[model samples]
Target: MSRTVFCRKYQEELEGLERAPYPGPIGENIYETISKKAWQDWLSHQTMLINEKHLNMMDASSREYLKQEMQKFFAGEDYDKAEGYVPPVEKE
Candidate 1:
């Protein structure tokens, strides 16, 4: 996908999140930090939406296509030496 389209789609989700309300400090912190449990909760909610609205909403194919594109993007670089390829766990 073109960067413009990708940004447009991503901007919408981010804007939605910006407008969403958090009920408590912990929930607000999770939304900002994306902690493991928060990630899992987000994953579960997304999964439910995917299963129930495969045809009703969301571009399901976009996920698979983006995955392949991202893989292709990183295939040429060495994991240990690649520029801007920091492993999350290894980051300090």
Candidate 2:
């Protein structure tokens, strides 16, 4: 899918699903929801790749980025805030 189309579709879906992370008041911020939905889509693509290639391999950086992105999302952090947030490096 083209980047532009994917972003538009993902944003529309996120707006339809998901509730506010906090109970006080819901604002215009849609970062967490959008990030989660986008991540899920991306993961699905990766799953397809794994099934097609018969190899359980994914890039370390990409995995790390996803982890951190989810964490920030749950924390109610927007993409701008989460941009600098990186997950701890895993030692094998």
- For each candidate, what is the lDDT? 0.36, 0.43
Error of 2 at 84 (Å): 37
The backbone clash count of each candidate, in order, is 0, 0
- Across 1-92, the per-residue lDDT of candidate 2 in tens digits comes to 21222133234433322443334423224333444455465455445434543443377765555455544544546522323334457899
Off by over 4 Å in 1: 1-32, 55-92
* Residue pairs in collision within model 2: none
Query: What residue pairs are clashing in model 1?
Result: none
Off by over 4 Å in 2: 1-34, 58-92
TM-scores, one per candidate:
0.27, 0.28
The digit string of per-residue lDDT tens for model 1 on 1-92 reads: 21111122122222123321346874454344333333444444445434544423356685554334333322332212223433346566
On lDDT, the candidate that comes out on top is 2
Cα lDDT of model 1 overall?
A: 0.36
Candidate 1 TM-score, C-alpha based: 0.27
